[model samples]
Target: MFFLKYLPTQSLILNYQEHFPDGAEPKIASRLEMLREASLLLRDLEDFFRAHDFSLTRFLICVILDRADEQGGLQHSEIVERIDVSSPVISRSLKSLIDERFVCVESETEGRRTKRNRLTDAGKARLQSLMPGYYEILLK
Candidate 1:
């Protein structure tokens, strides 16, 4: 006895019930539609990132660093865990960011080696430059 208040057409609902047989679960269908929409949004974001010569991972790292705690920054291991990327991939991205002067790293030896990363002024600017376009795409 599920009901959809905003169904496009009665005929569409009838067709859906026919296809589904037992009953038409509009909520499940709506959830699936939402997932599809999210996938499309991600695709758009990826395309935008590619056109800007920035990989999504790199952009995400900059964002993470930008929002990191004020105490200092996140360690390499913490970043790896947060992003769910392999150490090698994270290392390569960090190296590229460092080369581009978008990020800085500091190493410490508090019992064990720790490398902390934070965004540079340039990184913040880069992210800021992209935000307008990102927001426009999302709004559309």
Candidate 2:
């Protein structure tokens, strides 16, 4: 999403070469273009999720849990380790999911104090319903 609208990129790169000939990184243009494209893709995904009234964070957490699925589900710490998001955001989203009946917290079979978050049957159904649209956006 970062672009020099007033100046063409080649012009900007040429200007940089004129000013800092030795410091001109040969791959800067390609790197910037890559980053810009990635940013725009992410922006589109965010817009799509919002348009559906769904959260990308919650969706990611669901995906992580689904992939690492066990009867008792994954522990809170395990969820944190899988995702790049901050703990508090994960905590808030995870907690809301429980309230929405999409996820449930249960004790481990062994006598551990740790809590595990499992997706409900309803949750699985919701995930199934969302996947087609999600793939559509990705494939698009």
Candidate 3:
């Protein structure tokens, strides 16, 4: 029942009911379970990165940078929106990346607060290096 929530909302509920006709099916409970599983997986991955002194937040930031627009770059705010993390969280992560030489602020846009973040050579390589292991856990 709890596991059903992890799936896409519409499909998950119907699928769960089909599988477990006798079980109670509640959207809230299902979503909660899904959130729990997602959190668990994130924790597991975070622990994995921590062992190697890598921050998961930074890794996610790097991922966002890799998915740059057609021009191969993105604004910092876009990163925040895409990752669905708070500004402070993204700021902290970006700092880590800047320190590690993985990313840099390429330019300041029209707005005073908006800065375009670009992946440096090292940043691109680092992301590429991490993808295999990241996807291994991610896909699992």
Maximum-lDDT candidate = 1
Candidate ordering by lDDT (highest first):
1, 2, 3
Q: Write the per-residue lDDT of candidate 1 for residues 1-140, one digit (tens) a residue.
A: 13233535545555667567565566656765666677777788889989998977898898888889374778888889889789999899988999999999876556556778989899899989888878987998
Worst 10 residues of 3 by lDDT: 1-10
User: Which residue pairs of candidate 1 clash?
Assistant: none
> What are the per-residue Cα lDDT tens digits for candidate 2 across 37-124?
6676677778877886678888888887777676568998888898988899999999888988889998876787988898888878
On TM-score, the candidate that comes out on top is 2
- Please give the range of 10 consecutive residues that has the lowest summed lDDT in model 2: 1-10
Q: What is the lDDT of residue 125 in candidate 1?
A: 97
lDDT of each: 0.80, 0.78, 0.75
Model 2, total clashes: 0
Candidate 3 residue lDDT tens string, 1-140: 12232445655566667565544567555656678888778877887788767878888887778777345577767788888779998888898888888888865655577568888989989888877878888878
TM-score of structure candidate 1 = 0.74
Pick by TM-score: 1 or 2, better one: 2
Model 3: residues >4 Å from true position, as ranges?
1-33, 69-72, 108-114
